[model samples]
Each structure stands twice: as C-alpha cells, then as structure tokens.
Target: MVDKALNDLLTLWVTIEPIGTVVLFATLSAHLPQAQRRKVALKAVFYSTIILLGSIVVGQIILSAMQIRLISLQVAGGLILFLFALQMVFDFSHERPATPEKGHDISVFPLAVPSIAGAEAIMAVVLLTDNHVYSISSQFVTACVVVCIMSVTYGLMLLAEPILRIIGKNGAAILERVTGMILAALAVELIMEAIGVQRWIN
Candidate 1:
C-alpha cells in the first residue's frame, strides 16, 4: 500500500508538474493586480481539481463504454502530450501571450486544461485506477493523492509572484523549455509502455 501510494504520488506529480504550471501562471498573470492573480490562481486550481476528480471517477467508464482499451488511451494521450510539449518548446507566445484577446481568462485556457489537468495527467489517473489492477480502496487512495497534488499546485500558484521575483522572466522561460523537454521524454515513455516495449524486451 505504501509503495502504491508513493508511486501514485510521483506519477501525479510528474504528470501535473506543478512547478512548470507555476512558471506559466506567473508569466501569464504578471500584469494583473494581486487580488486578481489570487482569484485566477484559485480558479485555475479549482477547475483543474474538478477536472482531475471527474476523470478519476468517470473516465474509465466512458472509455469502457466506448470499448476503448487502456493501452490505446495511453498512446493517444502520449501523442497529444507530445504535441503540447512541442508547443511549449517552440512557441514563445504560448508561454506568454502578448495580446489580451489571446491571454484573456487564461485560468481556463492553457492553465486549467493542458497545463494542469492535461491529457497525460487524465490518462495517468485512469490507468492508475484500472479495475483489473487496483482495488476500490487503492483507487480511492490514488484519488486522494490527486487532491494532495492539486493542493500543492494551488499553493505554488499562490506563491508564483514571489517565486517569479526570484527567477525573473528569463529564468521562467528557461524553466518552461526544460519542462517541455521532460514532458516530451515522458510522452515517449508512455507510448513505449503502451506498446509493451518493456515486456517484449524482458
């Protein structure tokens, strides 16, 4: 149980990547007032938490109803996450939108969606709670880990201002790029696992 909990926590942490989310949130909400930043941070975290929890609850049912296999979902999610990571790595505007129209209500856009509760993260939670592999109690524990991760994410976003003060724009940009690389690697690993590469090798 301890091992499973620790593994779930680490998986959730990597997939969610709260530090990367903090950098992006700080960059996007830098111009807003302190109160507004707080609101945006809270909303983003709130929406993301809801999304992850929903995925944990109903995502498997939806997939099963559609007769979709978990391996297929893993491959699809990897592809999507790879594309998103490319955007992060190559698109400067994606990191910090210059226009208000593009940046408006960023909490719901990139922040809550692909940034926090991303395809990879959603797929990960579903896979972790696989009915064949994990019991109800284990799945419930995984859900709790998801909430804990989101809580930490909220705390990081709230502290984004002070963290940004230390890192500065250039540092944030570098961090974003690094995060993209890490995500790309993880995506490839997910795809490999979905294809049973490790099992074949063994």
Candidate 2:
C-alpha cells in the first residue's frame, strides 16, 4: 500500500510538473519589484492550490454534471495542451508581457490558473480521483499528495527570481512548448484508453 501510494504521488507530480509552473511564474513576475514579485508569486501558487485541490474534490462531478464525456474532455484538453506546449517548444509566444509595464497585476490570469493549474492539471486531478482505479483510502492519500504538491509549488514560486535568471526568458518559453507537447501526447493517450475501456464495457 505504501509503495502504491508513493507511486501514485510520483505520477501525479510528473503529470503536474512543478518546474514548469515555476518557469511560467518567473516569466510572469519579471517586471515587479523583488518584494512585490514575491508576493505575486505566493498568491499565484495559492490560487493554483485552491484550483487544483478543488478539482480533486469536485472537478469530476462538475464534468459529469456538464455531460462532458471523458474522451471528449481528453481531446479538448489535448488541444489546449498542444497549444501551450507548442509555445514552449517553438519559442513563439512572448515570454513576458511586452513593454514591461511596472506594477502590473498578472498573478491570477495566465500565471496561476491556466498555466499552472490549467485544464490538463485539472484533468489529472480528476483522473487521480477516479473511483474505479483508486479506492477510498487511495483517494484520501492522493488528496494528501495534492497538499504536498501545493507546498512544493509555493516554494518553487518563491524562488522565481533566481530561477528566471538561471533559465532566461527564451529558455523558459522553449521549456513551456516542450511541456505542451508532452501534455498533448498524454491527452491523446488518455482519449485512446477511454475509448478502449468504453468499447470493452459495451
């Protein structure tokens, strides 16, 4: 049981990589003062924690109530992931906001919500909470894992200053594109598996 829980937690981390979120965060906080940047970074991680944990607890139910099939969700999530990844890989998108306005408030928009705890992240939470694969105890353990990941995310964001310098704007953009590609591939795999499972059940 311990081994399984650890494995699931690790898998969850890989699916929602902290480093990528850290990079995006560094990019977003580029213009703010060190103190202000730190504050924004903290808030961004806080928002991500709220969004992701919410997804873990009630996201699956919301999707069900919306009548969105898992397969469809996969395909749609794939597209979004692909776009985000494409930006990472190709280095096409502006790494930071152009003109670099001072004291801009961008913690919640692209940084925290979609970039960090985006659709793919929410999907991972829902999948992790799947009752068919994980027992009640497993679900509870996974929730604990989410809490730990949130801590990790907050810690990573706090180091946004050094992280940004280490991996410059261009480097960060490239990384995001690659992450997007991986997310796209995962999304495709998920849709395929859902189709196969539905077919078997039918």
Candidate 3:
C-alpha cells in the first residue's frame, strides 16, 4: 500500500521531497522552545495541507485557461525556486535559535510557500493532467496521495524537535545549503528545457 501510494503520486512525491520538508521544518522552527514547537509545526502543516489541496483542485485548470504554456510555467517556477534557495542559504545562523525573528515567521513564508507547496510542486501538478500519462482514476488516486504525503509532513515536523537536538543547528544549516544547491541546479535545468537546450532525460 505504501508502494501503491508512492506510485500514484510519484511525480509530486519526488518534487515535494520529504527531506526538503525536514529542512524547512528544522529551519523555521529553529527559534522556538519545545512547547511552542508543536504549535508552530501544527500551524505550518495545516497551512501546507490547505495549499496542497487547493492547488490539486484548481491549479491545472487555471494554468490551462490562462493560456500558460508549460515552458513558461517551468521558467517561472524555476525562478521562484531560485529565490527560495537564496533565502535558505543566507538565513542560517550559528547562534542558538531562540526568540522570534523579524520578517521570518515559522508558520508562513518559506514553510508554506516554496517549502511545502513550492513552485516545483505546483508545476508538477500542472503537468500531471496529461491525457496519455495517466487515467482519471489514477489522477484522483494521486490527489489522495497528495493528502497522505502532507499528513506525513505534519508528523515529520513534530519529530523534528528531538532530531534537531541530535543534529544541532549547524548540521541543519548545512543540510539547507545542500538542498539549495540542488534547487539551483533544478532551476537551471528548467531554464535549459524551456529554451530548447535540453529535453526530458527520463
């Protein structure tokens, strides 16, 4: 059943990347105490669930109706992702993560936007509605798969607290930089494909 779920939402699961969820959770909750950590995690996850479900329902239709081409969407999404990557790279600090930081809230911004329902996630969902790629029933299953993945995300955040103690803030910051590098590469790939310099490898 786990395999089946993965198969159904394979594209999205890959783009969403549970590891990325861990990074976002760790980064955003860096400044919170143990008690407030749970509340913040719940809030982020709840916001993430809303965005995921909303995107699944209306994202493709809106994109198609707006006459937005896939290439255009890719370029746009990629740029957005690049900006997000930049944010992650510079936001990490060596000091202990305590007290609320200005302009950076755990509940929104990086967590909900590019973290959970980021540009990659949105673009992949838009591409999922292909006629030959999957059947309608399969697509519906994928939507349910989206929900399951988000539920896992919620659980992962709560779990991040203890994990944070083990890894420490420095380790989490290193992970964030690595993910940023990956996202930067992904962004370059999108621009390449959009410009006809490359095509799907797989």
Best model number under lDDT: 1
- For 3-99, candidate 3 gives per-residue lDDT tens digits of 6456657777787776777766775576678887888777776787777666667776776799876568677767877776776667545564475
- Runs of candidate 3 exceeding 4 Å displacement: 1-6, 90-106, 127-139, 173-183, 199-202
TM-score, one value per model: 0.69, 0.65, 0.71
Cα deviation of 109 in candidate 3 (Å)? 2.8
Model 1: residues with Cα > 4 Å off, grouped in runs: 66-104, 166-202
Model 1's number of clashes is 0
Clashing pairs in 1: none
Q: How does candidate 1 fare on TM-score?
A: 0.69
Better of 1 and 3 by lDDT: 1
Alpha-carbon lDDT, every model: 0.81, 0.68, 0.71
Q: Candidate 1: lDDT of 91?
A: 63
Model 2 regions more than 4 Å off:
70-105, 164-202
| Number of the predicted model whose TM-score against the real structure is largest | 3
lDDT of 3: 0.71
